[model samples]
Target: MRPIGIVSILREQTPAPDRSFNFLMAAAGNNTGNLLFTHAVWEHLPGPKERIGFQFDPDKVNATCRAVVFPAANWFGAHVDLADFADRVERLDVPVTMIGLGAQDHDFTGKVDVPEGTLRFVRAVAERSRSISVRGTYTRDILARHGFRDVTVTGCPSLYQPLQPDAERRLLENAKSTLGPTLLHSTRFSARYRAFVDTPSIHLDLYRYAYRTRSDLLFQSELEEISLLVEAAKKPDIDDALIATLLDLYGAASWEELQAYLHNSARVFFDIPAWTQAMTGYGRAYGTRLHATIMALNSGVPALLVHHDSRTREVCEFADLPSLKASRAALDEDAISKSITRADFGKFLKTRGRNQETYRAFLADNGLL
Candidate 1:
């Protein structure tokens, strides 16, 4: 178990590097797999091996480490000049593998914003890397469209640290039946999309909302605001109910009286596991937020998605997971009802599982596994 040095972004507050380095090192490749990434990703991965971090010097790395792994798009400070970074790394004369996070390629409507200076950066990235891995097929297609015929692989990090089917399945099996059809929303709702809601049939904006989820996902929030001034408000099915119930899972309360009980539920709450346990308590979920959808799926609970932007859509599409238009029009009672009633629990699992395996195959093919 020779040590490997992983270069990734972190909060600058990690206690110390642990098994994650080895975990990443193996899954990414012989050269790619030995490194760990704390990029725009999960906080931790556990392994039984000790690996060095930046705290160690280059000489120590060259002498004892196996190879390096980097997903330079850590979503951090300063724009990445891909060419320059590639040059700097190549100059080290050490083996390298790159995880290309092209997650920003497709919007909810399946369109993408070709960010300024991005193509050039990717070319530079292509020019420098020994190998490349894209997050999804959509991105892989986009890269192909751009003439990036380099050795690009398709692997989704959301499915990178794979979970067991049994583990996720039991979560759904054990979920309180009352929590069915989990509706998940993030605090990520934007004000711009709100403007579109005020003018429904006449004004069309959802297909171009860019970063807003289809209006249907936020039914609870919408209804709450609508209820403040209306006679009879709309009711949510499993899709719409997930948002409220998830909040309920977090002590928000199932009903008003339960809301009061949760006010002091602090007396019974711990920080971390409570959140994990709460997350595990969903049977089926429809989410507008990426991680919410991710956790639900990883937990084996059937999850449907509402896309607010390209990132969400690309991720789900890459994983071959399903997403419904979160457009305001789609959020109406009829559409929402149809989406919920037509919810294909079997398809949700089958599709994402196939995608997960595809990602795994990329890893194996790339020598990461």
Candidate 2:
């Protein structure tokens, strides 16, 4: 098997000189989730592995690998320069398979119109590749409208990752019993974005709910790490404006108090193994953090997603993972308990297995497997 080039947001470094500061900040939370699917694609394909540089050079990449794999997300958003990315990818003559691509939306149900730049990118991908793997029905439909019929509705790769079934069952039993008081609440409050109008309020509501309920809130995004670094006076590159914005978004009176609060009642994770390790004793996990909920599900813990936008909602709906819309109204413990009890791992895992087969077929049909 010839090496296949994988190009993605692989956040494999701290002081990443290759990426922009904004990209690095976003990657802190997104990289692992993206890699969850990318790695699965790599293993599925016939290849000796070669990670293509984030800096896309067509001739150099083509010379090294048989094909290129792009694990994409929310490609229909306004923030990314899809035109530039398409232009660069167009220069490559190798086969490209874009897995788990999606479009961002303002709400859980509404769809954002795809821009010309995004359409161009999709066209370029369609021209070079066999089929594009999408996140859900919404993304598939969006591409269909733009004349891309080869799109496959493969749910995000996070749902199909490896899990410890026996270990998870024991944890679930503990949750069902009275021995576990610990609840995991995942929230994302720090990011500069324009698509979701209710994201900040939704996060604030989740934070308040976690605080009132005494749940151990978890932070997965880079902003959490950035805040920790700034507090420790370790991130010398961060500007005062960025620090002020971060502090304001953190919703704390002081940096020390924020640190104290997190240290006492919250936990931060940088990788999957440590995250699953931490999930062992927790009774339930609930909040807007999509992957965090998925991680819990994969770990055998009952979890619920507080879906604030289209991406989370569609993925949950497709994968049969338990989820609810983001609301400012307070959610009582009784309601939370009901949702947790209703989470059926047996059903969800069955659906996940089926979706994985479909995803594998998609890769095979495209000549990757």
Report the poorest 10 consecutive residues by lDDT, candidate 1: 264-273
Compared with the true structure, what per-residue lDDT tens digits does model 1 show for residues 1-369?
Answer: 553345553322211134242332222321211122232223322222233433445465567656555553322112333444433443443455556465453233434445435555455545544456775565666667667666453444644444435754553343334344334343322223443344432113321121123222221122232122222213223244444543333333344543333232211111223333554544555546555455555655555577655555666665655566556335332454455445554565566577556555544544445
The runs of at least 3 residues in candidate 1 whose Cα sits more than 4 Å from the true structure, single-residue gaps closed, are 9-64, 71-84, 103-130, 151-155, 164-183, 187-275, 328-341
Which lDDT tens digits does candidate 2 get at residues 217-324?
A: 776554544455322323335455545544565555665665566667776554456667878777777777777888777777778787877788789889988777
Note each model's CA RMSD in angstroms: 11.9, 4.0
Local distance difference test, per candidate?
Answer: 0.43, 0.67
Q: What's the true lDDT of residue 260 in model 2? A: 67
**Candidate 1 vs. truth: CA RMSD?**
11.9
Top candidate (lDDT) = 2
How big is the positional error of residue 119 in model 1, measured in Å on the Cα after superposition? 5.9
